[model samples]
Target: MPRYDYRCRACGDTFEVSRPMSEASESASCPKGHADTVKLLSTVAVTSRGGAVPPSPAGGGGGCCGGGCGC
Candidate 1:
């Protein structure tokens, strides 16, 4: 199950619900029992154990992959 954020227009209330991806577009009833609600776009933050990603080489690189063409 995935959590979704919803905002009620009738009562101006916000709530969260967990449901299947297939039901992601389904309208959810607010806690106040308002059916006129809309799902909100959410943001996700990603982190890696390897730390930040390294910057790519300037002006691109060799025609080969990974700039390791021995140019």
Candidate 2:
């Protein structure tokens, strides 16, 4: 099974569903009873080990250090 994000055209609500690949593309309606819905092309974040790592700031700070954070 694969997870897919769907947006309801009638209600403008976004939700996620986990289903089979074949049904994923066909089923785009919201489970809350919205029929005029479409599947949205959502992105998933993934990280690689030691892949063009960015440099960090010299000083240690709280929260984000502003070191080329992708998030």
Candidate 3:
């Protein structure tokens, strides 16, 4: 299940709800029972379990752009 953030205009309260992706657009009520609510745009950060490392150049440091160009 994915979590969605919603804000209630009636009470000006924010709450989180967990539901399936199919119901992501469904309306969510506030904890205070306010129906005038709107879904908030949120950001999700996904990380790898193994901490994978990206491949670098043969020289490992020198590239077109200063110090951190993996190309």
Q: Name the top TM-score candidate.
A: 1
Candidate ranking (lDDT, best to worst): 1, 3, 2
Distance from true location, Cα of 28 in model 3, Å: 1.0
For residues 29-48, could you state the per-residue lDDT of candidate 1 as single tens digits?
Answer: 99988899999999988889
lDDT of 2 at 56: 56
Q: Candidate 2 — which pairs collide?
A: none
Clashing pairs in 3: none
1-71: candidate 3 lDDT, tens digit per residue: 89999999998988999999999999988888889999999998898887887766565566566356654
Q: Which ranking of candidates, highest TM-score first? A: 1, 3, 2
C-alpha RMSD in Å of predicted model 2 compared with the true structure: 9.5
Q: Model 1: residues >4 Å from true position, as ranges?
A: 57-71
Indicate the worst ten consecutive residues by lDDT in candidate 3.
62-71
The residue ranges of model 2 lying beyond 4 angstroms of the native Cα positions read 51-71
lDDT of each: 0.89, 0.77, 0.86
Tell me how candidate 3 scores on lDDT. Answer: 0.86
TM-score of each: 0.74, 0.59, 0.66
In candidate 1, which residue pairs clash?
none
Candidate 2 at residue 65, lDDT?
Answer: 44
For model 2, how does the per-residue alpha-carbon lDDT over 1-71 read when each residue is reduced to its tens digit? 68988889888899988888878668666778989888888887999988987765654343554434433
